[model samples]
Target: MKIKFFRTIWWKLLVSYLCLILITTVISYILTTATFRTIRIKERQMEIEIRVERIARIIGELCKEDEKIENIKGNFNEIARISGIPLQMLNPEGKVVAFSRSSHPKFRQIKNINLQPFEMRKLREGKKFSYTQYYGENRKKLYYYICPIYREGNFKGSLVTAVPLGLSRGFAIMLLNSVLIATIIAFILAVFLSRSFTRPIRRMGEAAQSMAHGDFTKKMKLSRKDELGFLADAFDEMSSQLKRNIESRMKLMGDISHDLSTPLTTIQAIAEAICDGVIDTEEGRKKYLESILNQTRRLSFLINDITELSKFEAGEVKINKTLFDVVEPIQRAVESAGFLAGKKEIQIEISIEDEKLQALGDMEKILKAIQNLINNAVQHNPPGTKIRISATKEKEKVLFSVEDNGQGIPEEEIENIFNRFHKVDKARTSGASRSGLGLAIVEEILKAHGEEISVTSSQQGSRFFFYLPYLDPASADVFLDK
Candidate 1:
């Protein structure tokens, strides 16, 4: 399926960062531009007021020297040329006395300008007034400053100065260009940072998709020392486990078919021979039927073992708990298997550190597990071999082991002995217990009790051992009746 640009993590991250940068740039531009304009306006206003006030004081001093019109015009023209401010002198009655030719044409065209009532009052009170206006075709800004000239507390005339806005349009243009450049830089950096953060997420999504399609061999190879790295490691572990499970399942099916077919094939042939009267004697027919019965029993045993192992693996078996002396079940299993051992003249013995060593677990399952181990030992051993069953206390638990003086398992097969349907080919043909689920079931029972079983073997013998938790002494009172 095609993914939309907006839905992908990389695209989303890039867009989000771009939006944030654009917003910040806009806000920064607005604030900075406003502040700069404000400062420029304030500076222009102050310069106009100071220059006009100084001219007013100079005009007052000149009025004291000579009241000649020609003299005042000359002085005003000189001051305008030097200060770069357009100047005009006005009589107290609001008539223009002198005007600088340096002033804008619009200003020279005005013969007289009456001040507002409030403005005139301010001038009469020996104060100055300032205002701004736009003039000319280009609508350039202009600042007007007016102050009353005084000679020894006597008002002589008003001094007026006009100053054009000092700041040029070029400065604003430069500031705008600067903001644009900053925005571009910020956007580039945003893309880089966003990509760095979202790259891992993109890889994870791809890996997940691959896994969904039953591809367990793919692995995520992130090297970051963060949560993402940990997630990658966990994903690899899960993939490996899944692969093992699939392989084991396939192998189990094949083993089941091969093992089950052997007995059925034998039974079919033997029964067909008897039915066809191929055995000429009645005794031969009876022996053939007995052989068929043995095969039938073997098939039943195999099926039962498979079913029970499945229950144990699925956690469906409920253990009935009780407190019992550990020796009792071990002794019981030995007694049950003694008849078979006697046929081979093998002597089975039992040893205990304490006969009364008690454990908490399912009694029936424990007895069955012990019997399977003893039967295995008897089947594998030569005639006159000695089998020993021992139980001893080990701190808070009891250790039980079955040891046999028989040809030991090879090192390579030891690890797989407890795997379901795992059979030693040599041991099977040597007339050892052929059903391969015995040790597997025993391991499952131990696992259900939260214990583990181990084996140690050499050419001389093999020993299988496991630990069972001892019944707590303080809780023994509760089970005194049993």
Candidate 2:
């Protein structure tokens, strides 16, 4: 059940934070307890040393065998009371001679828990100046300390002090109450912190979901200058761009429909006029009918291009890969543009040196892309200008390009000309080009075949370029078998 955490970043962040806090708390607890115990032991032992030293000084001048030892024994209890600890004194023979406590709690069994007699005898032979131990005879918890006493350069007795291992009742209650208060305060702060961190994330997530559902109207909210804020701003920019594209496509579709309808209406009206004898002469009627027919053909061509573009963009178009000669197809495309070239008095030329230059790709789409580029060059060229188409085998790829010595594209619209239904200006297009789907259709088809296409235009002229996979002699023959 614990193995499924790789699904997202937030879960990992929460787990990482939990682990880091727990590890830090454990280390802090260990270090704090060690320091506190060392401090407590040192404080208790310092007071014991002072008491033993004073007693040694008082009894140091006493001559032979005085019974003041009883008075001195009572002083041990006074030291324990003043220092907030219990005292157990052992003779040099290691017997438990005395013990003192004001009151014992009900949970304690005082009499059954005592120090071992033999353990004290080894300590009193002028052995340890001071030491400490925990636990008692009945296995109850205690902290026992031993200190040897001296008088006139002879061993008098030993002091065994035992402090309860548990905290005092009042202190224990106070610490527990403090912990409860701290926990409540920390939990409230934690809630506020969690909200501060997750609120921006939630807002970003909702905006993303709306974009996924094709509603690009909403923008992400951002409040900070961190990575999240940068991400939010980027997302907002993406949404604005997407909204503009969607609106443009809708407007273009309406324009395309109107263009096609107007052409068809002209053709229909011309046919009706000819049938009704509205034109008195046959020659006049024939010319009007031919003009209407030309517009009808243009509408048909535009519809076919739009359909191909949709298939390509939707990834529904299939590529039939085969080895084919690149030079002949390019020549054919230029020849097809001869009429437009003649009308503008522009010369169309094709240059190729590699007769065996072969490319593996869909020949039909390649032909269409070249045709569109040539048509663009022809339509946009001034009189007496020249356009050229060329192909060459470069390493593993076949490169094709169409170049025109024309007024070239404007600096601003060169990159955007391939976008769906985008045009630089209304005055610069053919009569039917308010739809503006030419370059977009060309780009989509080439892209579907895993090919690259681009255009560059400057004062030197404009070049439209693309590439296809080059196949050698043996590989080209192998393709012919399939």
Model 2 misplaced stretches (Cα beyond 4 Å): 1-46, 49-166, 169-185, 209-218, 221-227, 268-292, 319-321, 334-351, 354-360, 377-436, 444-482
Ten contiguous residues minimizing lDDT sum, candidate 1: 425-434
Candidate lDDT scores, in order, read: 0.82, 0.69
Candidate 2 accuracy as TM-score: 0.66
Model 2 clash tally, residue pairs: 0
The estimated TM-scores of all candidates read 0.81, 0.66
Backbone atom clashes (below 3 Å) for every candidate: 0, 0
Best by TM-score: 1
Return the lDDT, model 2, position 192.
64
lDDT score at residue 35, model 1, on the 0-100 scale? 86
lDDT of 2 by residue, 30-65 (tens): 565557656765675566566655543453333234
**How well does model 1 score by local distance difference test?**
0.82
